[model samples]
Target chain A: MKKPDTAKQMTIARLLLQGNEACVKGALAAGCRFYAGYPITPASEIMEAMARDLPRAGGSFIQMEDEIASLGAVLGASLTGAKSMTATSGPGFSLMQEHIGYACMAEIPCVIVDVMRGGPSTGLPTQGAQGDVMQARWGTHGDHPIIVLAPSSVYDFYELTIQAFNLSERYRTPVIMLADEAVAHVRESIVLPEAGKVAIEDRAGPTVPPEWYIPYADPGSGIPPMPRFGDGYRYNVTGLTHDVRGYPTTRKDEVEPLISRLFSKISKDIDRLQWFDSYYTEDALVTVIAYGSVARAGLQAVKEARIKGMKAGLVKLKVLWPFMRQTIDAVMGNSSRILVPEMNMGQLSREVKRVNRGNCEVMTLNKYDGTLITPLEILRKLEEIYPC
Target chain B: MLETAHPIHKYLRSSKKFPHIWCAGCGSGIFMNALIRAIDRSGLAKDDIVLVSGIGCSSRLPIYVDFNTVHTTHGRALTFATGIKLANPALKVITIMGDGDAVSIGGNHFIHAARRNVEIASFIINNQIYGMTGGQCSPTTPHGVKTVSSPYGNAENNFDICALAEAAGASFVGRSTVYHTPLLDRLIDKALDKKGFSMVEVISQCVTHGSRWMGLNSPVDMMKWLKEHSLTVEKAKGLGETERKDKIIIGIMADLDRPTYNEEYDRFTR
Candidate 1:
């Protein structure tokens, strides 16, 4: 394993950068060569940065007509063996769901950055909200598994963008970087790493001859090497369920394993697939579970509660899909009470409750008015539960 | 009878499975033949070309040719083709669509792609009706044309595709018809050689759909109508706007220098 040079160069410093800007830098460092997106607020900076930097790095950047085309272009680029991505917000993300499912069904490796704003439909374009947690998991129709990662800070926006790419390439699936407006617009100091110092993952290419290659046939790693077009590999890939040869298959025998592997590939490899940050859970009777920008408030409230002589801990989820039930259950299992805060009406909280199975009371603090969850409100909830 | 010589025929096999899905005498086959000829003449290897299409009868052109092809969703051929082009700019990307596929459902993508001037050759087979969907009035269906959707007559005015292409900022825009075989062959050849967004709108005959609905029984009759209605751009220039308004203008409408979307995009990254 090549050690990241910057891993040893520890200078705990900061640089002011927007969350979207950080995402662009992280994408650049991760060897992303193509970006196709339409400009939508809170996420427009990502497009601007990519439009400026992609060409300089000998990559491609395009402002497509709409979010559908943006993601469609990214998927098309991914098939040609390019590290491609696109960014959008709520309404745009809604338009991209169909193609997103296509990427999932095709097992194409690409990234979609959703800098979420409040919505059922263009509710709040400038404000932050985590209402898309359920949408990120179930936006696309059908029973397909997805990888969704949420970043809490500007630095994580950069760091997680790289991880999103790596995970997509590793799993051969569309990995979503789900960010809300707060993180997208937030300006913070992020240290730039020297070149050749960040970990990157490249998609696996066919090791066998083109004739011997089955594009969708897994090679023990649960990911089949992709052979690009114009590489003398003639294969058919459809949005329909397909067999190893990439041809659409409807046989009972073929359908079972095809769908089963889609779930198992990510589920069985949960260790490398899941990520979260936990705090102060050693002897706490009360815990808080949150993600994205809301988790920052959750962490602060936990700290405040600890100072007020309340034993409160935090479970900040990074990976939001395949639910990470075991990790979540383990962290919140012994707690007397758990607070699940989000920008929506307890979407993630419902998942927490479903997995908790009555072992601990799962309470929800949801705000859907397109505002970030305030640390004070969370503290007030904590005080009510374990009154000072 | 004049013999049609298309170079792409050399790469094609005349077999049972290869008979093609186009109706017997449909002009789309002629355009497809011309495209294959252009591809063969370009000297680019067959393996290096990627043909993308949206859902429509004309969009089926890619299925007959031996190349990397994607028959994607309706009106999304440009988006998919754009993706393919960006991924491997080395691979020659060509997209084919019909009137509705390119102008109606796919209009947003079409204009934006042209505005960006992505390095792609978009061939819009303008048969004036949605042939695949049973002769519904299309974006290019002429006003007063009777069809399934337009029972009495098509109330909407048609879009002049070449004019639209020129207005949308395509570096190259040309028009031809199945009747103007030699000119179409030359136009397609030139369009392929051009480096930016090249769009060739081929006026075609949907005899089985449009003609049957409009009371024309045979493909020959439809072909005859196309020949009589089509005029060269030079001929149309001499006529008054009202006189030649509805005439199909056949020739290259615009060809100018502009950096392609990929070229401009690459500049930003560097």
Candidate 2:
């Protein structure tokens, strides 16, 4: 096959796109050929875009009966060698938690988009909150491993969504893109990445023939090569803790290694998984740490603090799960105080304190009234911490 | 002379861990026997068949079958089958669910799958009790029957599985008891060839838990009860409604030509 000129496709055009719209574009670019979702506020735009565009690109789109079935379909399609995804919000996310655990236990590669909205049960459908950070970590039952990514802008939404698929496929696990309503609905101008410039990852397929293949054999990579259905592998996939052959087993010898491998596969690669963007933290006394839309406010707050001759910097986390501890410790080493601001009752702030190392005074600014934290509020916390 | 093995043995997984979990005389084993025979008769390639199931004793059937199998979460097998069928329309997808797994927790998915008329063969093994989680009353449990959950008596009315499937717009619907194994095999064989959603409600026995509650002492007694209560659809058509009360109508209920979801989707997209 002749290689098409990627340079012509790289003719960059700046266009205004909503974060959710950008997410759909990224999914399609990442070879996501299957999407099954039920409409939920703020996240509905992502589903709508997929429904309109997936079929034209020779992909499939389905609107499931509810969120549970939506995630079920996504997992099912993923097993058939398709990059599949589903988009939903808080209430819907809660419904999908069971299947999320199934995907984790079964080691299926799929992406889930949860647009954060005010919750505890439909608290603020139209408004955004960062309340689901902890839920994203522990929503599914058991100590199974998961990867979550957050985006701060429309551009980040596009890039991180593609990254989410890559991580899930490479790791053979579920990856969640946890975007808040603010980021999902916000429109911004971004120059689309050139076709060849963006990297896409497909799930590794089995190298051996069907007779010799063990469906869950780790083979030293901490991940087994996956086989698609109808590929003559005829292997079984179950949610049960199974042996390498994929039959349900309760033996301690089999269960222990299976669960450990699930965690070790990601923990061994924690350095690459802990993605963040730090700004002006070289010689700062007070550092602001945040993610999603709150990070945008943190950046603005640090900028104002810098202008006022205060040593302040920002660390915006792009990957939220496998919790960015090493990065937080590095930030804490240089800064005497850290202000963790979020649109929830201090979910991520708890993580910051857990890894504080007692060198810095870790403080939190939590707003749970279904609104984003403003830069001024963060600045006030910084002033209080510095006592200037 | 070499004696040939049973035809069904060829379809059993080489790695199948058996001394199967089902209690002695559980109807799921009977259904599995009939299913393999039916598949053997149909002559479909094992590689092209995908078997999906939800959580229950019946759902465990997929692990023993030599095909692409997925044992999914409770009450979500149809959704998974829907995805698999759409992702590869050429693959024959079949979902095996139990009473609670199908009509109770997975009721919404069940009806929608039928309504979409997706090309899938869904079999609901209605033993009328939650066998795996102990003998709890299920959605198809007879009203006023005693169960662990319904110690006094079942307060809820039972669902008519065949009627529900037909009402939900399934292209093919059938009902047969484990006693009628040959008919069950034939019905399942026909369902496999259906181009859209097809379902067979198997009124099988749950001798361990369900029989204890129903006052049936043994598997033979339960089989006798099924034989006495079930009437072929043609036989029941001549009987009055009063006479047909509580009778399990057996045989094909509906078969119609409809535009399947996968076919319609492919036509428009291609």
Best by TM-score: 2
DockQ (model 2, Cα): 0.82
Question: Where in model 2 is the C-alpha error above 4 Å?
Answer: A1-10, B1-4
DockQ of each: 0.44, 0.82
* Candidate 1 CAPRI classification by DockQ: acceptable
Model 1 spans > 4 angstroms off:
A1-14, A191-198, A218-222, A234-264, A386-388, B1-26, B240-246, B262-270
Top-scoring candidate (DockQ): 2
Prediction RMSDs, each to the true structure: 4.8, 3.4
lDDT of 2 by residue, B133-204 (tens): 989999999899888999899999999988999999999999999999988988999899999999999999
Taking the tens digit of each residue's C-alpha lDDT, what string does model 1 give over B136-234? 999898888788898898899988888888999999999999988999988888888889999999999998888855577888898888888888988
lDDT of 2 by residue, A321-381 (tens): 9898999989989998888899998899999999877988988898989878899998888
Please give the CA lDDT of all the candidate structures.
0.85, 0.92
Query: Highest lDDT, which number?
Result: 2
Q: What is the TM-score of chain B alone in each candidate?
A: 0.94, 0.97
